[model samples]
Target: MASETDLGHALPASLSRPVLLSAVGRVMKSARAAAFTAEEQNSPLALRAYDLRHAAVSTWLAAGTPPPLVAKWAGHSVQVLLTVYAHAVDGQEDAARMRIERALADDDEAA
Candidate 1:
């Protein structure tokens, strides 16, 4: 819910991108420190604010959003989206297969 210019909270327009990014990074760091063990806090799995976008794209893909739509949402070309998100999409192969199997069964019953 936190936005670069969230309602009810205002960032001074004079602030630069680096400053804003650093502030968000510090907030993410503190949140991780509170929620994670020391080892996990130190790990690469520690989430940065930028990681939020990645998580959203991955979640949308996993939730069965089509690639072209996800690409548009992320402001990426379909090729770029697939190239970058191929790993996240790869995890859905089994789910896709199961869906196909169920559809085939439904078709058989309808016939």
Candidate 2:
């Protein structure tokens, strides 16, 4: 394992892939053994570190983080981010409708 310092320079952000998989596999195996139900034991919870990254990105999109910011954080170009994760963005229909309605109302008042 890598060592860390208070300055954060000595730390590696993550375990090497092989070491991470070994450690997570051991934990998952123990958790499966202790699961109360067969379905619970069989569920694919935290199966890989990549799954957590996907969840985090999806969550950020759902929480209304700007696409550009999310793209930067995820190390993706904005176009690629939208192409891959657009489905995670929610309620565009209602929001768009509200904006259009406000625009029309403003035009009516201006006229």
Candidate 3:
């Protein structure tokens, strides 16, 4: 039998696709996601194995990974990456408002 371990990667290099899917299924069966609604348990939700890739991409983007690099890693065109992952980038409105307030306060102090 071939070696299954992959150095530096959580997924083994030789893990069969079916086994990988089964592993994800086992985790989902035990995770809180198992309690989710039928709609919430559908594809593109965390219940599916593919959702891990979505989470990974979204996480990298949320952690400030550059768009071009993310696109490259995701094997997508920059435009497609931006369009698809836009929903992953959230919660900037409050930060922007605070920055504007700070800038205005600094201007008032200068004046």
Each model's lDDT comes to 0.81, 0.76, 0.73
Off by over 4 Å in 1: 1-19, 91-94, 97-111
lDDT of 3 by residue, 1-111 (tens): 344433233554456345666876788766635577767656455756567788999988877677888888888898998899997667656756787899999999999
State in Å the error of residue 1, model 3. 13
Off by over 4 Å in 2: 1-38, 95-111
Residues 6-63 of candidate 1 have per-residue lDDT tens digits of: 2246555565235567888888889998989989987876477767789889888878
Model 2 residue 1 CA deviation in Å: 15
Cα TM-score per model: 0.64, 0.55, 0.47
**lDDT-based ranking:** 1, 2, 3
Q: TM-score rank, highest first? A: 1, 2, 3
RMSD of each: 6.0, 6.3, 7.1
Model 2, span 1-111: residue lDDT tens: 666644345655474234656887787677667854776666676555566688999888877778998998888999999998989886667766787899999999999
Please give me the total number of clashing residue pairs in predicted model 1.
0
Pick by TM-score: which candidate is best?
Answer: 1
- Model 3 TM-score is 0.47
